[model samples]
Target: MKFKNRRAMLWHFLKGNKRFFVLSILFSGLVSLLDLINPKIIGFTVDSVIGTEETALSPYLESLILQIGGLPYLKQHIFSIALVVLFVAFLAALCRFLFRLFNSMAAEKLIKRMRDLLYEHIIYLPFSWHNQNQTGDIIQRCTSDVEVIKNFFAEHLTNLLRVVLLIVLAVYFMSGIHVGLTVLSAAFIPVIVGYSFLFHHRIGESFRKVDIMEGQLSAVAQENLTGVRVVRAFGREAYEKDRFEEMNQKYMNTWIHLMKLLSAFWASGDLIGGLQVMLVVAVGAVLTIRGAITTGEYIAFVSYNAMLTWPVRMLGRVISEMSKAGISIDRIAYILNSPVEEDPEEPVNAPLDQDICFDHVSFSYGGESPEVLKDISFTIKAGSTVGILGGTGSGKSTLMYLLDRLYNIEPDEGKITIGGVDIAQMDRRYLREHIGMVLQEPYLFSGTVADNIAITQESTEMAEVRAAAKIAALDEAIGKFGKGYETYVGERGVTLSGGQKQRVAIAQMLIRKPEIMIFDDSLSAVDAETDAKIRKALGERTDQATVILIAHRITTLMKADNIIVLDHGRIAESGTHEELLSRNGFYRRIYDLQSPEEA
Candidate 1:
């Protein structure tokens, strides 16, 4: 889904929970109205009941007072006036409670919807999008940036509404006592709000810089943790520590600078608020002395003026803090706005167990970069084993990636077809499910050995897990563990060796029983003996399925039905193992170097 603007996005997330906020606003307005009643009550008590002055109350209030028995009864039962004040306070507190309850419910729901949508969108985003983005930055957007938006809605947005209502209502009430004083007090509202807006506007770029630095800091920590093994092996602990410390120091300095500006803004607000309060107090006293307003009216006007001061100033703080949300929203929008991987409206479900052809295929990582695979054309016949041999950067794995649609082969560059059906026309999910390609660096989630093997299935049977493991030559190693198939693999299979992790990945793919399987140097971590066992098992078991093996080792591919040599992203040679050796081309030279005595 795409959002036209930040407001549109916010409104979209607020859909289901808007009713809660509506109720919250109703209660909040009631609270403000309730709060206005007490000052009036205090003024009425002081003037009409205690002093010998007539009440200047609204007709509704006067009728109610008459119902309770006139001024004579109120004067006789003075404590009843205190009781009325306490009663109004109780109602105000109740309304405030309901307001908070409803507001909290709305905020929680909003946050949940935002997080769920973000996670779902990120999961379905194209692999190319993920490749171009950093894990740490994406994590920051999903987590920290999400929290900022939550605060924006839950605190600043709601509070801004409440405070603004309070300020307006307070001014309205104060005007009932003295219009000139009320006007003078309300004039400060715009000045304070405008000042805060301008200050925050200037500081917004600073906040953005800090946010970017924070993501970088997270990236540094994530990268270090992920490559801890390498760091330890190289004894680069001190270097890594220094690097992290430097980044952390910069992050701290940026935050400190922001806090200093925040302190200045708050201090300035307090000074302005104090001046406003002084002017109201001094003017109310002058009016009282001149007999222009009663002492009771002066007291109530001062009370109402004080009410306006804080919330008016708070209006500024809220507006300033909310500016941060704009930055956070844009950051999150970058993720939500990205188009997800999509298939054709009518995707084809073509049979995968047939000739797979790469026709004049050319690919570059990015369009402008030099090609990784240039004009590569080949065909893998049905139920046949084909071996791809190449050194590093020879487009060995790139070919398999194209076939599986992990990366699309451009229409102008070429197209890959399975059973004469373009893979692009095939449902991406269906294509990937049928073609299993294990990478050189295998990643295992934190789980038991059996759990990792049966990950593809929602409900697993121990029998199937063991069968796949046995084929991958992992059953023996698993049996040796004290917990056997139930043995827990630590994060990324850190508890297991490299060879063990690769075997687990192999078993994972094997359990799916895909029609087309590609091992992209997945066996590189294992010894020759284990490699031969796994390949032999696959050869016997997968006779009816098509298999493509990618490896740098000659012995691994020597027995395949067909061998294709890749050199610098082009097809160097293609034939049976013996046929390539007879021709004495690039494949023959690689064979001679690896098996010199045999050659």
Candidate 2:
């Protein structure tokens, strides 16, 4: 859950492809050796080309090489130095190519796993968490934030390691040429690193601002796309365009700020590196002209100094990259590791015979707002039908949500029970799986009619699917489509009429055949005749299943075995429809308001 250490994060990624890590280290180490050899080869080439008899010993390689084999061979047929030089250059290029190829593959594979894991985590997060969080913010964290981390893992992570390796190799050879110069060049890098850290602290908050801007952009994009119809219908294109431009400008400003600071870091590193090169060249050139060191030695020292600059420059770049990556990592990890819907870890089924109770249940969306549903108690025996009628915001839909355990309830409150067991004791997944829901607004995925109806590939038979469709009065509508059951619906079933979409949503639930069936104002889209037919079919099919209906129309719920009329968050009237009507109470008031004469 906690990525407290860098090595651990790296190790987690490496676990995905241990072979790649092995090759990365192997190739980098081999490349370091070849890198160290380049300067030595150049130094010898200078001596050999000039036919110099005296050879200056490398302090680093001297202990290893002269201790084993003497430099006497350099005094003889030194023509072999060219071949050695070519061999060193060849090995360096080969190792670099392999290291780059393998490290990139490793980063890509690691990122894929990370992205999937984060996506799965988001899916499991509770409704409450998502409600409080912005969709655009979550989207930005998943996309752009993850991209920065992936880029770091891909190029910069290895480059950081490569730079360190090159520094070590370059220093050993530089000390061979001139120890004083080696120390002087190496000392300036830490100051550059210190400056980079200073910049990180100064701009760390700006990176967070960039993330915020990205989220705002994402929210705007999602809104524009989802509500395109509304915007166009209202003729607000120019207004929205101006608004979008404002959002874009904010995003552009944040990006420019980050770029400016990063540019300063890059420019500073280049300036120092230029001066370092000039100083080292001046010192090395003087030694060569004074007859203390050969022209070849001087040239090799210059080459080594040039090699050393890359690592110094890499230090600046790596720190900046990692600083940004750190911010992104923390943001992403926070979301991916968040607590999710608190379902039972190991799920079990509820008893089939027990009554489903809503015991003094209460809930609120957030803040100090009054509860959406107050302390209200009710019971539905197995195989019974219950109907709820309420004005808007009277908690009709919220009541149905409790049966599916979409919202967590306090244990101290009156609890819902299936048979004798409490609903909260039952797993959230099990409760949802066993409860079928059809919302007021139906959302159909972009898939074939049959595919949408049979959401799960398992337990879906063609005959059963068609049967369910017929029960929901969707069979005739499907038949009219060009491809019938195979017809592909566009996003959210935009191709289908509102009534047809409702029927398809009903058909989907019918295929599931859950223990608790809820129609939350689901038939409001259809005309009275179609609504009646669908209700008749539902009553026939779910005779033994517990049915809960929330409706605005009197005819929709006129046949309910038990009806509860709600005012505010409490039950205002509860009885058989006729009994409530006969009492001349809240139910009658609704009947008079909605349908003066009941059909």
Q: Give the best candidate by lDDT.
A: 1
User: What pairs collide in candidate 1?
Assistant: none
Each prediction's Cα lDDT score?
Answer: 0.88, 0.78
- Per-residue lDDT value at 415 in model 2: 70
TM-scores of all predicted structures: 0.94, 0.88
Candidate 2's C-alpha runs over 4 A off are 1-14, 56-81, 191-222, 245-269, 342-348, 365-367, 457-459, 492-494, 596-598
> In candidate 1, what residue range of length 10 has the lowest lDDT sum?
590-599
> TM-score for model 2?
0.88
Q: What local lDDT does model 1 show for residue 544?
A: 82
Best by TM-score: 1
lDDT of candidate 2 vs native?
Answer: 0.78
Residues 1-599, candidate 1: write the lDDT tens digits: 89999999999889899999889888988998898888888888888788887867789988988998989999999999899899999999999999999989998998899999999999999888999998867987888888888889888888888888888788777888889988888898899888877887788789889978987898899989999999999999999999999999999999999999999988988898899889989988999899888878888888888777767766766787897788889999999999998899999898999999989999999946688998999999999999999999999988888888888877799988899999999899999898887878888778888888888888978999999999899999999998898888977443898999899999999888899889999898999889989988997893488989999988888888899999999999899998999998998888888864532
